[model samples]
Target chain A: MKSAAMSEAAPATTSLPYTDTKPAGHADFYFAINATFRFILRHRGEEALRSCWRDIGGSYYRPVSKQWTEQGMHGVAEYWRAFFKAEPGAEVEVVESADEVRLEVARCPAIHHLRTHGREIVPQFCQHCYFVNEAIASPAGLTARVCGGNGTCTQRFIKRTVEAEAQNLEDIATAS
Target chain B: MIGCYDFCGHYEWTFEWLRQQGGHELVRAYWDEAIHQDSQLHASQLIGEKGIEGMKEYWGPTLADEGAVYERTVTEDVFRIDMHECPSKGFLLRNGLHQYADYCDHCMGWIGPLMQKAGFVIDHEHNHCGQCWWEMRRIDDASPASAPGTLAGTSDVRLRPGWKSPATDHYERATDPDDKT
Candidate 1:
């Protein structure tokens, strides 16, 4: 299992749908991400916030879904590899096999950055990975499940089928 | 995961999402509450405590870290920025993502309120092509916005031949996003 520690390594050219002139993103933006989630949750309640997450996965990320549909599991692996690389302070490994892609997030960058900066992370912060990823996965004949969070987690993307177990929200941790 | 590398993409997408859920007022509230008060608290604190110097302190490293190509001109009475290529808008333009009708307005939506709290007012304009200029002065300063090249010298963004757009939004002594004309 080769895991890329993005903090120490130079950025590799990625297959990301959106490319920026900067190699990695400014970590401070995590503050905005946390704040946006808090705002939505407060103003609209949990269900509406989750719906917004789903909409992001389905609509904003439609291009990534299209690529996954065309290229199958390979596209999923490539996307995560590139995605994590562009996130500053991310420590993740994308392990790909014939059946699925698993992201072993050793240090969830958003949580780490937020904590370091003393930002009050929304409690529901970590669940976004599940909601957004699942929405992105389902349309490509795939599904995602996440477990463990608040600085470390396992996210798996696998083929969608009747036998696949549904994700348990309890598996995702709440941020402090 | 909603990674920050494409934060502008989803951030822009979120504007439309909030609008759909609760209309434009919700979007406005999101900017003022979520962005100005929450996300950019450091900016608010700095500008509030230090005024013009704080604007320089805040935007200096922030823009550099974001890989923006721009110039800044600061005086005793004003702090001005000429954004030649806005990194946020550039990312969205390069990625072909346009969810909200006017994505550029998000800046004013948050910064306007921040300036208001800091006892400063803004004179600004954006061509919506990644070119914009901002001048921040004390609220009581009666001096109007300087002519294009005066404050920033030749670095003024408005001097560029391509800086004009029929859709260009302008603000004078604005303390709210809706103050644009």
Candidate 2:
């Protein structure tokens, strides 16, 4: 009988990956939630990085700004180069093994919203969404369970290793 | 693919323990009330340039007094750590000092005090799902749709319309060989 910001807009047929209870009646809930989730999943690192860029590109940030851009993104791409190095300025390592799913997070900016008007239901949205893979490291990942208020996740990020395409941030930064 | 599976496997072992333990804690089940109440707690509701009085009423010392994991995220300015539930990309650790952007120029909003008292911050992960793990090698094994290019399939993308910033439109006029300026 609990109502959430999206519950009213979510449909009864759609089941939350998080909870057992069906929603009351919002039809768009399924679409919104799924869209937001998939969006985060697809653009996880890229989106988080872009948040800081947006603040910089806009007039919203300055020397003393307390924005995510100001507090985070201190070293920029250079931080990751040192972080991923075996011993600073070393050769790039391949993520050949699953055990080493480690990556350092630098300058993460994430903001997503879930909104609903009378009949319209909005899905959850944020900078990025972790995957079922991410859950593997945590207990929730272990059992595929949902914790917290009604199984809704809080936005967060963790770093991991992945190969770079021909063009990438670190490559661009290191070029000069 | 077991390697990828292991790489993608998610597991959390702590927040449950804390959530289960009986202690002096403030855990909200449904945050709708907070959302509704804060709407009226608008920027103009208070008097003065910065509303220091309202701010004092809003924020207090952070739960830094409590025993917990905390970090000052450089990019996000998210300085709190989750005690247990590490869900993934969406499961972020945030004092979420940035959530109160509506009123305060520097997170001087009520959310700041709220973050302070809560001690550790775990965001509601507005990101609906994880990222797209798809790679395209062939297009339908032939042509048609694949000729121009393939579309990159994304993961859950609920809160995403205004997500990307549009480029500025300050294009200069075309130059003509015969035209004299």
Candidate 3:
């Protein structure tokens, strides 16, 4: 975790868009995230949960969208690099190039922690990566596609001008 | 992805989103159903089976993991906590994220129902400045919350000069977040 002062001193200089006092976030919060998804799906429906994801990506992450818009692929790469670094137990490799950024998730910290603690994960858990990331990327003239899940996945963020197929929800595996 | 690194930021934002989707009732339901019943089931099981001991078992490692600066006091009759610096609220404050109204109430929103299910009542107060105290007693105890310094001695959060704020919300023998004064 980066300090608030550090983030303030040079917002663009830091890899993470937001900073916290701790080096890494407490993994237990993953429980709440899964539970929140479960509650919305049960009480409202699948659409409502997806809307929640979009709202978070679009509104809550507006700063990130702004950064991605201003700095392009570099901003996306920096953000993911810092993001995975602050997620405890995450084993991710962020590869950035001129046109896109790809995240190779070897072990997802949230899934690992929830599974280790015997928490029942939402089946559509991996879809959140596409919905939320797409919402964030769209505003920056980019798009996100995710494939595989449960324990590992490949996430790619590419410029909207690049010809690419839309993400198929089926391609994202159901989390056990 | 909704990363946990800034969970509180999005968590608070989600509260407002739920309120807009359904109303305050939906937000309340989310806390009881999602948080107390599902997310924190371990806490429920522990406190339900062991009472005060369960609170210690649950909060000790939990608070430490969240990087909270606080103190806990326990006795045969009650379990008390003095939160000098709440990590959750502090994060929102530090990052200037305030999407929900009275984000502090979220604690009671879930914990109150959990404690009620376990046959206990809560006496709690938060100043919205990351300073608060909690005293939990059996449903039949009826003892009011201890005065500053009585329960946690020098660690009493109420004794802090900044503990009193105009935005302070207080509760006494309550099991509902709406029961605050």
Predictions in order: lDDT: 0.91, 0.21, 0.90
lDDT tens per residue, model 3, B45-125: 999999999999999888877778888888999899888878899889988999998899899999999999999999999
Q: Is candidate 1 or candidate 3 better by lDDT?
A: 1
Rank order (by DockQ, best first):
3, 1, 2
Write out the backbone clash pairs for model 3: A1-A23
Q: How do all models score by TM-score?
A: 0.96, 0.17, 0.96
Of 2 and 3, which scores higher on TM-score?
Answer: 3
Candidate 1 regions exceeding 4 Å error are: A1-13
Candidate 1 is scored at a TM of 0.96
Task: Write the residue-wise lDDT of candidate 2 on B72-175 in tens digits.
Answer: 11111222121111122222222111221111111112233333233312121111122111111111122121111122112112123432223211101101
Q: How does candidate 2 score on lDDT? A: 0.21
DockQ of predicted model 3: 0.50
Q: How displaced is residue A89 in candidate 1, in Å?
A: 0.4
State in Å the error of residue A160, model 3. Answer: 0.3
**Ranking, lDDT, top scorer first:** 1, 3, 2
True contacts kept of 1: 0.68
* DockQ result, candidate 1: 0.44
Tens-place lDDT digits, model 1, residues B7-125: 99999999999999899899999999999999999999999999999998999889888878899999999999999988899888877889899999999999999999999999999
Off-target runs (Cα >4 Å) in candidate 2 are A1-125, A131-133, A136-176, B1-23, B28-181
